[model samples]
Structure formats: structure tokens, C-alpha cells
Target: MTVKQLSSSGQFNILCMPEPEREIDGVYIGDLLSWVMGKAEADNVWITIMSNINVIAVASLSDVSCVLLAEDVTLESDVLNTAKEKGINILSTPLSAYEAALKVSGMI
Candidate 1:
């Protein structure tokens, strides 16, 4: 299913949708930028506890479709703005990464 649908209709919260036009395989954990770059696929919904601007950068570099902040965290305006400029999707939810992963995994 689409990331937007998963967040809006599924069981998770999605914050931003810069590139909502894209579809991902499973909900990929958006943590350890380098690790994700090497491990995540192009269609994975990134679920990370990080809210740094670097997260957006890595998302772009990794060719990811969207990012989900899996926690009640606040992303800096600059980070969100960068994501918009980069055309990367961003989201946030009260659930932790692990929890979000579980919910997303069940979907696919």
C-alpha cells in the first residue's frame, strides 16, 4: 500500500508527504543513516527516531520515498523545509520505531 494510505488509513501516523506520489515495499526503519542507505530499498517507508536535518539528506541520498519519525518528536523547521526542497516525504507518529515497524510490517 502507499505510504500516505498506510499513515492516513492504516495504523500509523504520517507527518509529511513531500513525495506522496511514490510507493514503498515495507516500512523501513529510518535510523543509522549509513545503515539504511545500505539496507533499505527504494520503496520502504522509513521509520526513524531521528529528527535531524541529516535524516532528510540521507533519505535523498539513499533514494528513499518517505521518512517517518516514529515517536512524539519535533523536527526542526529547517529539517522539514529541507525535506520539502529535496522532494522527500516525511512523517511523524507517537509510536516508537519498533512499534511502527510492527504495524507497518503487518500491513504488507
Candidate 2:
């Protein structure tokens, strides 16, 4: 399913907008920045508790579809702004990345 679709479906929340939906139909990876950049694939829905500018940087470098800042974490204003400019989609979620991962896994 597409990112928008997934969000509206109530299965997952869309933390970022204008994001590509790649891994939604497959799997989700909820690792930290370093591991995610090396191991996650493009179009994958990346869920992490981190809510910093670096997360956006990692998402951009890795070409991820979107990022879910889970566990009630939020990004800095500048980070969100930069991500928007970079065409990176980052979403904030009430649930932690671990929770989102589990829900996403069960759906796919």
C-alpha cells in the first residue's frame, strides 16, 4: 500500500508527507541511524525513536520513503524544515518505533 493509504487505513500512522511507499507492502526496519543506513532498503518505512536532524540526513542518504519518529519523539523545527526541502518525508507518532514495527509486520 502507498504511504497515504497506509496512514488512512489505521494500521499505521504517516509521520511524513510526500514520502514514497516502498517497504509498507513488505517489511519494516526499526533500527538506529547507523544500522539503518547500512541495512535498510529504499522505500522501506523506517521506524525509530530518534527525533533529530540526523534521522532526516540518514533517511535522505539511504533514500528511504518515509520516517516514523515514534515513542512520542519529535524533530526539531529546523530538521523538519530541512527534510521538507530535501523532499524527505518524516512523520511523528505517538507510539514507539517498536510498536509501529510490530503493527506494520502483522499487516504485511
Candidate 3:
């Protein structure tokens, strides 16, 4: 599933849609930035509760299709802007990280 389709399916709230058409090959759920950096595969949707600027960096470095912020986590203006500038798609959801991961798994 693409990021745009995922957002339109009513499962997630898109906070920053810089690359909505990006394809999601799989899902990776983790909060530890270092672990995610080493393990997250390209084209996978990374699901986490982290809403920091470093999330953008990790997503970029890991080459994930997008970043899904679980638990309704909100990003700061600067972080959001930087994500947009960097062409990183970010989706938010009220569900916990586990719930979001399950939903993404079903979609993919």
C-alpha cells in the first residue's frame, strides 16, 4: 500500500505528507532510534511514538517509505517543516504502536 492510500483508508492522520505516493513494502515498529537505524528496511513504514527531529534523520538514513507516529504524538513546527523540506512522509494515529503496526501489516 502507498502512504496516500493508507492515509485515505481512515486508519491514520497525515501530519506531513511530503511523499504520499511512496510505496510501503512492510512495517517496522520501534522506539529506539539506534536500533531502528540499523534494522529498518527500505520501503517499510516505520511506526514509532517518537516525534523528534531525529525521527526525520533516522527515516532518511534508513530509507523507510514513511514514518508513522503512534499514540497521537505531535511534532514541533521546526521538525514538521524539516520533514517537509526533506521529503519525508509522516502519518499520525491515535492508536498505540502495536495497534498501528497490526493495521499496517494487514494493509501491506
Candidate 4:
């Protein structure tokens, strides 16, 4: 599924969608930035609770389809802006990372 389709499906709330047409091939759930960077596959939806600026860097490096900020985590204004400038698709959800991952898994 594409980021736009996923967001419009009402499974999660989209926060920043600079690349809504990005394709989602899989899902990755992680909190450690380094771990996620090393393990997350390209074109996967990354689910994490961390909403820092570093998340944008990791997402760009890993080339993930999008970042799902779980458990209602909110990003700082600068971080959100950076995500937009960097063309990162970020979605937010009240669900935990596990739940978000499960939903994404079912989707793709």
C-alpha cells in the first residue's frame, strides 16, 4: 500500500506527509535509533515512539516508506518541519508501536 492510501484508510492520523505516494512494502517496529537504522528495510513503514529530529535522519538514511509515531507521540515543530523539508512521510497514532505494526503488517 502507499502512504496516502494507508493514511486515508483511517487506520492512523497522518502528521507530516511529504511523500504520500511512497510505497509501503513492509513494517518495522523499533525505538532504538541505531538499531532501526541497521535493521529497517527500505520501503517499510517504521513504527516508533521516538519523535525526535534524529528520527527524520534515520528515516532518510533507511529510505523507509514512512514513519509511524505511535502512542500519540508528538514531534517538535522543528523536527516536523525538518521531516517536511526532507520529504519524510510521518503518521501518528494513539495505538502503541505493537498495534501500529500489526495494522501496517495487515495492510502490506
Whole-model Cα lDDT per candidate? 0.77, 0.70, 0.92, 0.92
Candidate 1 C-alpha lDDT tens digits along 15-81: 5677776877876775688899899887887788888888987889878767877777878888888
After superposition, which runs of candidate 1 have C-alpha atoms over 4 Å from their true positions? none
**Candidate 4 residue-wise lDDT, 1-108, digit = tens:** 899999997979988898989999999999999999999999999999998889999999999999999999999999999999999999999999888888888878
| Residue-by-residue lDDT tens digits, candidate 3, 54-106 | 99999998999999998999999999999999999999999999999999888
Worst 10 residues of 2 by lDDT: 19-28
Q: Write the per-residue lDDT of candidate 2 for residues 1-108, one digit (tens) a residue.
A: 666665665644554576555445444566567899888887777877777778878988987777776777767778878888887876666776677777666655
Ordered by lDDT, highest first, the candidates read 4, 3, 1, 2
At residue 11, candidate 2 shows an lDDT of 48
TM-score of 1: 0.87
Clashes per candidate (backbone, < 3 Å): 6, 7, 0, 0
Tell me the spans in candidate 2 whose CA falls farther than 4 Å from its real position: 11-15, 20-23, 27-31
RMSD, candidate 3, Å: 0.7
Model 1 Cα displacement at 107 (Å)?
2.0
List all candidate RMSDs to the true structure: 1.7, 2.3, 0.7, 0.7
- Looking at candidate 1, the ten consecutive residues that score lowest on lDDT are 7-16
